[model samples]
Target: MLYSMSFPLSHNDKNKYRYSHHNGDSTCKGIDVHEIFMTKSRVRLLLSHIGILVCLVNCYISLVKDKLCSSSIWKITVIILFAKFMQYKPVKKESLVILPEFGLQLETHYWSGKIARRFVPGGKILRPVLNECVTPFTCYWSLALILHGEDQLMLVFQELKPPLKLLVPIWKALRSSFDVKEGSSA
Candidate 1:
């Protein structure tokens, strides 16, 4: 896939600009002045290039060792590219938290090591439909104790309960903790 970007001609200019494209004729669009603001950085551009290379390598490896079909290879490549370059993050874990007190706390985690914590003060847990993961890849989902900052984090969700309306945003943020860091696997 080819990527292109547009930039304003200058601070004083608005409509006139130029676009750079990897392949094909790049055309600049004339939108209202400052309709949307976009900024690019060298690090992000470099990472995008690296992401493409990784996708290619992964596709080749899957094709060689796994003997995956060409279509599957393409699918995997697309997934990797979309994941890495397009900044689409995979949901790592979702959970309902049970605090020590009578109330409860909800937590969400991402592979990027960012934790989303939601606290419901004095929120009583009537009952917990606790589902435990006995082994790795159980139910195609495994539970492993991994150290997260100061806490040992669980990779699987054990409790079943939807957070309250106020906590929904917190859950959403926790689910989206995919903010890629300098050296994250996400």
Candidate 2:
């Protein structure tokens, strides 16, 4: 009998070493969309979320630590907004591609006409679509914060949460009235 050990590295130890070596600059740049799409485990999803949370933390840190002036901060925020919007665009397209590919992959792998029966909605579809639809409002809220300062920003941010709930309706009404009044006067 022969025993073979691969890499002589325990999984936990390898993970620890990998993480310790990353200095926050190691982003999700190299992650394969197909791998994420194929992963059905909640733990993997949670880990992905954790990575995004880390990036958000880094963004907050840079915003604070740079001690940027108000105007410069606003500009930086706009740039970040654009980057986020663009990042989601490719994801959205990939998601659209995946829906049809999923059917094909399932058909080829299972060799059954019942393959479609096993289909479940995937995050690849939901996340990108939701993000695309929400991007404008997201940009709006962030820009509002940059323009109006933290106190007002908090109020607006809370309103923009979801489904246009909370203060958004009232805010929009006020904005429309304000615009109407301006047009009438002009």
Candidate 3:
């Protein structure tokens, strides 16, 4: 183990997190040979479509809120797309439930999960990972939004009825897990 000696680095691991390395970053911990080029995980598989949908929703909500008193906003597409591509099933468009104390929770016959992302105080944070049944990576529920007040939550729920219903529970759970204050927000 001297400067004169050499070493060999081999990807004997099948884990996508272990195969590819991104400059000492944990985000690239799992990068399989096949996955390195194009990672098709549940979360990232359809990010392109999700990003577009998020943008469109934001634009629509902004326009409506500008002209009107206020508007409801929902990101059901995130879960629907998540379920369709990741879960291989149709998500219940109307069954989203919100528990202010609990944050947001996605529950159904086919699958159940939360729209959450655990918080990290500082340091290097890895890329977000999509959560399925078995494997949940770091910051699993990274999409949960923290509402400052109850009125804010109600107003949001008004515009978008489907998925925001669950945002509360997801946020609550995440907050509890991360030791966030009840009235605090991200």
Clashes of each: 0, 0, 25
* Residue range 103-136, candidate 1, lDDT tens digits: 3344555545786766543322222221233455
Candidate 2's displacement at residue 57, Å, is 0.9
Off by over 4 Å in 3: 1-15, 20-45, 61-68, 72-186
* Top-lDDT structure, candidate number: 1
Mind giving the per-residue lDDT tens digits that candidate 2 earns over 1-186?
A: 111212333544333111001111245322111200121335645665665565566567767877676765775676566545433111110111123223101111111222222222222221111111246444322112111122222121211222222123323332342233433421
The most accurate candidate by TM-score is 1
- Residue 149 lDDT, candidate 1, scale 0-100: 38
Distance from true position, residue 50, model 3, in Å?
A: 2.5
Judged by whole-model lDDT over C-alpha atoms, candidate 1 comes out at: 0.39
lDDT of 3 by residue, 56-164 (tens): 6756665566653333223444434544544322221212232323333332221233222222221221111112222454222123233443222112122112222
Q: Report how far residue 26 has shifted in candidate 1, in Å.
A: 32
TM-score winner, 1 or 2: 1
Candidate 2 lDDT: 0.29
What are the TM-scores, per candidate, against the unseen true structure? Answer: 0.24, 0.20, 0.18
How accurate locally, in lDDT, is each candidate? 0.39, 0.29, 0.30
lDDT score of residue 161 within candidate 1: 21
Question: Which ranges in model 1 have alpha carbons more than 4 Å from their true place?
Answer: 1-36, 69-78, 81-186
Q: After superposition, how far is residue 151 of candidate 1 from its true place, in Å?
A: 48
Model 3 TM-score is: 0.18
